[model samples]
Target chain A: MQFWPWYLGGVALTTVAVGHWLLMNRMMAVSGRVTALVNRVRFGPDKAPALSGKELEDALLAATLAAFGDEALKAPPTAPEPAPEPAPSARPQLTLTKPQGPGMHALFFFGLAIGGLLSVLLAGGLEVSPSLRGARFEALFDGPGRYAVLLLGGLCVGFGTRMTGGCTSGHGLCGVSRFQPASLLATAAFFGTGIVTSFAVALLLA
Target chain B: MADPPCPHMKSCEMYEIFTFSETLAVWKTRYCQSDYSRCERYQRALKGQPVPVNLLPNGHLLEK
Candidate 1:
């Protein structure tokens, strides 16, 4: 079968990872900026930069942004802005607090891992492929080995996706389109690792 | 302090916000894939966080 889908998926995922990383830098400036935003809103517009409606929401999103490990937010903000009546009290805290430890970051990674394992089993073991498994990948292994390689490859995808922050869909699709430098770096790491890993596996199996 | 883990549930951080970002950082995701059908599925999936997106070889669906 044509290995095109895998190839497309590979390139696309990389592009997104790269793009999103750059996007993060854009979204979260130095933590001080966050302080300035909160200060203006809480104290008064006259006290500092006025918080526009959009600015407020964007600031809230950043504060609320839990995706991609950001350790800075782990500790509670010194002076958090009061939440709107409609919003819950914890709203500001959850988004802005970064996971302090690697353990916290593991959740995102584990999520991807579960997703990867699911995809691998769905397409690999169950043999639920839209297309036949390509010969280039298959030639490296017989029946049992093929399944092993495929599953392992899927795990790698998940692990790598976690380490870099954002999976193929996250960085490759969403990020690359947005022109994020972080995503760009992540995409490169993904491709380089994937190619090297795939080569090592192919050689070992051969 | 964060919520304690319940007996039945694993220690999962509920979808809640802790702090706020000082900057107005906007993250846009671009999806490229053969299935235009799943575009909506993906769009819906990526509510505000980064998600996996499959793009075509040269389908330019994203720009600054």
Candidate 2:
């Protein structure tokens, strides 16, 4: 099969993980990032204000004042006068007390989808197919049954990742690279589980 | 205590002004992705309305 070499793929993944840490000062873990985004979305506008909007602004203002002295807060003499305030009733009202929904993680998740598409294009198009008795398996779990299994699997994966506090990308890639003991343990569990599951499935089929 | 000016209002502590349900609602919307589709913030963005900073999680400011 035509495929990217494992070494090259490893190098690319390492670069991405390192870049994520350098640029964002964050672990490149998709699950955690998604979880954070989910949390922000579930919380309503009332909680939004506390998520670093005004605090960020205040911090910046304080930094500027400290760096340049009180003069930084003063308007430049050449600056134009602020526009007259509109009547309160005439202004557009915002429900600032409500949750704002997904934040920047929206872009991250969206970018992940885009990246998948880009990879397919770069790889000269991907030919997807099921593995190991595909037709027989489809016949047995056709239609809604197949969907049910897929959904169940997804939920299991999500639950497992949350309970473990990391996923493959978080533990196997970022965590292992960092030499974290927890990540090493988790990665070992992942590999062991995969091996056991494969053998179990093979036995079942036999 | 009187509420601070909107510009000066910072920190999650400001949420105290809201009713318990209101605060809970915001919290649920932020942490629960399942309710995202029905969220007012998401709906407004869909309509091209400007969303304030508190609604967006801290991360790369795609547009600044």
Candidate 3:
């Protein structure tokens, strides 16, 4: 199986990142997008009230009247008494438009997963044999123990990503490409932590 | 009756009239559960095609 050159992959990523900015007017930060979605769900509808039924009806009536122009306004009242205008509180509350939604972020992650699956299939299926041979930590822990360690690592990664406001793709790929100072600092911290952890693990296992 | 100003109006001077949370609330629901696949831009993305700048609601991807 043949793999595409690393530079080609980089070029593709760069194109997508730039396209995201130009087309969506948004920075391509997968973690931040996902976090925003999560926050919306975690915070209920009360956090941001939708237009009340009366407000919606009032808005529709106003739009209809605007569309009819002077003819609607000039029409003589059929009844002896004219209808009163709705209260100010019943008016629709205007709000800012969002650029993108959670669904896009969900689809983006789905694409990432599909891309990985395609790469593995193209590489001629998954290898069944044990690939981690003679690793110091593998000898120290049994299968179940190794899984526990993995679960813990996974939790740490999820928590860390949330706390740091990004992951490798968000900070390293998109952020660094844009030359953000905070991203540079975060990326450096990520590498520094990984190096320190690896040495710590080796010492403990030995 | 005068039409209500759209919350998304680019002018920042209107900030005093509307609170930050009110603005954020509108954005939160704009694309929260929207179907991106229905968007022409998203379809272009799926086919590995170029996206146009004037595509509908580039962020929400929903035609208002």
Best by DockQ: 2
Query: Which of the predicted structures, 1 or 3, would earn the higher TM-score when compared with the native?
Result: 3
Instruction: Please tell me which predicted candidate would have the highest lDDT against the true structure.
Output: 2
Q: Evaluate residue A24 in candidate 2 and report its C-alpha lDDT on the 0 to 100 scale.
A: 68
lDDT of 3 by residue, A67-158 (tens): 44444344333323444545778654543333355677788888878876787687677444332344886787677777787778879988
Report clashes for each candidate as comma-separated counts: 47, 28, 3
Candidate 2 lDDT by residue in tens digits, A1-206: 35667898888788988997897666788887776566455653323333334444444344344444655545544445745667767644332333324565677788778877777778788655443336545766766777787778789888888877789999999888889887899999978998998788667765
Tell me which of candidates 1 and 3 scores higher on lDDT. Answer: 3
DockQ of 1: 0.03
Write model 1 residue lDDT over A88-110, tens digit each, in one string.
Answer: 55444322222223333344456
Report the lDDT tens digits of candidate 1 across residue range B1-64.
6333222111112111111332211111111212222343244333322211211112212111
True contacts kept of each: 0.02, 0.06, 0.00
Ranking by TM-score: 2, 3, 1
Please report the candidate that would top TM-score against the real structure: 2
Candidate 2 wrong stretches, greater than 4 Å: A45-102, A126-140, B1-64
After superposing candidate 1, which stretches have Cα over 4 Å from the reference? A1-139, A196-206, B1-64
**Greater-DockQ candidate between 1 and 2:** 2
Clashing pairs in 3: A99-B59, A99-B60, A100-B59
Indicate the residue-level lDDT of A108 in model 1.
40
DockQ of structure 3? 0.04
Q: What are the C-alpha RMSDs, in order, of all predicted structures?
A: 20.2, 15.3, 15.5
